[model samples]
Target: MTGRTGLEAVRIQHVLPYDPRQPGGVQTHTYALSRALSDVGHDSTIFAPSRPLRVSLGGTRADLALHPLDALALRRFLRLPHDLLHIQEPLLPAVGPLALLHPSPVPTVVTLHSAEVVAHRFYRWTAPLTRRLMRRADALICASPISHQTAVPAISYEPRIIYPCLDLAAFSAVTRNPEPNTILFVGRDEPRKGLTLLLRAIRQLPQAKLVIAGPVRHSTRQLADGRTTFLGPIPHEEIPLLMKSATCAAFPASGGEALGLVLIESMAAGVPLVASDIPGYRIATNNGDAALLSPPNDPDALAQNLLRLLDDAQLRERLANRGREAANRFDSHVIARQHLDLYQSLVPA
Candidate 1:
């Protein structure tokens, strides 16, 4: 009950480190939630780390763009708020949020979105520290059930599941008509995302074209067959159009994802998906039969799956129909309402 009047009385503040130019999944997720909440007559500000040159967009008036924090900066910064503070994290590499959580007046909720935490390889030492941070939260929201299950066993807290969302309507509307021979991939081009495998798969895929619309961290030279077009780091907004235009959106993650947001996005666009057979995709798609799920890290299998979808029409329609239905649960409006309900439940009546 601060900042604005009337329906805006129950204001909430969410702190995110969003850079418009290099926005990641967390930035997209947080901004979409804030926008959706605003549509439903709730007021919230996304306190992002300062933009490189202070770029302003239309929806920014309702959100705050804060500078990146030092030790002193965070101490002073966390002091101000609308109601509760929602921290979006992959978790800090060195120090956890204990410094902020210990004396903070605002009730905090954190949406955990890290594969490393579950994999237990990177920063294994911080397992205890991460759990401690979870205990301090007034509430916790996870991007997927896999993340929830991973974090739940390691920590004392049990977070609620709120899958990373997509603009379902936008995706659905965009994919009414499609292009032939165009394929899409929307993830970091690391070995983990199986870009290598995808590239290998593409070698066997004759005449079809693939556009890798993400960063290529490793040697792209090896994967550089004549048929592949590597358009590095396309904007998030532009991805839907790309997916819609494509014959199918591709994801072949080797390790795993908490949720396959891109898969659902492709599904929303009515693009058939060729993804890995992981628990995360299984959960996100609800086994919707929209995607061609195959074994992890297998280029041959990946290629075959993609080929199958491309060759067949009835299979594609089956996937498109089922994916459209399954993707409804992740609309920004519905997701924001779920978080709002959780917030209301957590706050004292």
Candidate 2:
């Protein structure tokens, strides 16, 4: 019912800029869904950072630009008729003003992507605010069951689980030739991502090569084993190829109480996964289907799991096959439809 309306009939407001140069799961998901919502014939407006890139996404007319909520000039734009307004993230640099604009006459939906307050120190200031904003929105969305379970207890209403999506077509460039021996980790080189433990795990398997493809700051240098290669933030378009080149993906994820998009992205590229045994990973994999799970934060356990997957080709194949199926659920188009349903539920077409 959400999308079953005319263009001017349903004005869905989305807040988030589409910056291709900056690669991140939230950026990808926000832009992809905003574009899809337009394709389904629903009119929408995008409010985001004050300074937006001059370029436009491939096929969506989101009227992209910065709306800096606090700006005096943008106050009039905020009053425009909108049936639904979707806020992507609840942390600062994003939700700061969006939260203030909440309880608007129009229905609002806020997504709790990460428990950054616990993950990073800078975000500690946002934890209480995040809890407050969660109660303010008419609807809430979570990328994983674990995320919802961890984040929603503080809010007045239960947050619905609507997994973040991936546009599979974006990764069609990857050539899936079946060489399941290498391991890839596509995340920033933060301490919480468990980079040190991954290095120790790689050390356990001498033959296995590891490629960590993300921005590696000084913290990354601390864990730099001469053998590991940091490709320095590859473009999202090339992520599939990078994953395809490897036998599987590795994520010693320890930062946030949320799901890792890289794991699903790797699976979509037909690459098996080797992830931490956290609640988020367990909910994402449904228990070791798309990846080999090891005890969380334990390099030795991760090493054993890596060694086991590397040595057993048949088991690796099984995981890959199962992972492919689970990955399908996160396809952008399918997930977009689910969001449409949620919006309609709140607006009541």
Candidate 3:
């Protein structure tokens, strides 16, 4: 049955390497894309291990850790009836490798979401196998140009660029009630996420009140003083409100970002942004036109950018307006239509 797009509805199975319940970009992308597809009358089902096994790398969770049993189960499930399969992070162990290597009857599309593919130990260790499995995909997509550049050398193929989708309406609906001199930061407690760097930056801005969302380590929690508030791991639905409450948002990721979805979310919420000037972030903010950018790992630069946004209301207004315009490009419905077109191209009429 055809829906609004005038194309037959397709059954799409999305395979995620990590637990969907976990708050992460891949999870959010899958959920948003699936919902958007469903809105246009497509059938979308998400599959992942009920409980993912965790591995720590440099004191942070390694998302690519192998789950052999889970991979085997996912491999078996791939045989089930489906019009198409959309696999995220196809090099990620166990779901990714097993799913990609599985001889499914349906067309498979794999999306590369990591910018640090060349540097990741797991990707390096399984390079040969990854190269082989990648060839089996019917189509390939990269979240951003940085991801494309990092993946092409390893996989030997250029993938079409497709930015991650977000629920722009929900974020746009948030009532803007910015608190004076308030800065909001949302990320997991990882070194790559640069929470420590943001903290150091906050030290330089004495009048800034920082609001942090997402999980935090005890040692890191100890660092928060009267000026900082930790609202650990809030529900995804509440992010819009949290974003709207701030005068501006900061994403100080040091490295290893494929696409900074938070940057897009901040833009959608019509909040001014101060983010690290990295490849992935640069793409998300349209070469830093939508936000103020600073050098990664430089606390002074980040602090200075944050202070500038706080002090200049006119600059904040201009960035927020530009951000909302940039964010419209990632609206879920628009991305869903692109996926629908890709699915149609793969499926026989």
Candidate maximizing lDDT:
3
**Which portions of model 1 miss their true places by more than 4 Å?**
1-9, 17-20, 51-77, 94-99, 117-124
lDDT of 1 at 116: 39
Q: Residues 1-349, candidate 3: write the lDDT tens digits.
A: 8866688989899998877777878888889999999988888988877657876644557554266677667766776778999998887645776787777888999998877644455656667877787889999998888777767645767788888888788898877989999999998998789998888889998899999999999988777779999999988888998987899999999878887888898999999999999988888888899999999999999999999999999999999999999888888998888888889999877
The C-alpha TM-scores of every prediction are 0.85, 0.82, 0.94
Residues 1-349, candidate 1: write the lDDT tens digits. 4322233345677766445356456666788788887777777776554433333322121122343443344455556655677777635331126333647666777877654333444335567766766677787777877776656544675677888766566677784566676778887765567888888888888968888887775576566678788788787777777776787778898754777777777778788788899888887777736678989988889989989988887888898888887788788888987887777666554
**Model 2 lDDT, residue 75, Cα:** 52
| Candidate 3: C-alpha lDDT | 0.85
Best by TM-score: 3
| Candidate 1 TM-score versus the reference | 0.85
Overall lDDT per candidate, in order of appearance: 0.69, 0.69, 0.85
> Model 3 — TM-score against the truth?
0.94
Cα lDDT for residue 341, model 3? 84
Predicted candidate 2 versus true structure: per-residue lDDT over 208-256, tens digit per residue: 8788887777765676676677788787777777866787778887646
Count of residue pairs whose backbone atoms collide, per candidate: 1, 2, 0
Q: What lDDT score is found at residue 274 in candidate 2?
A: 82
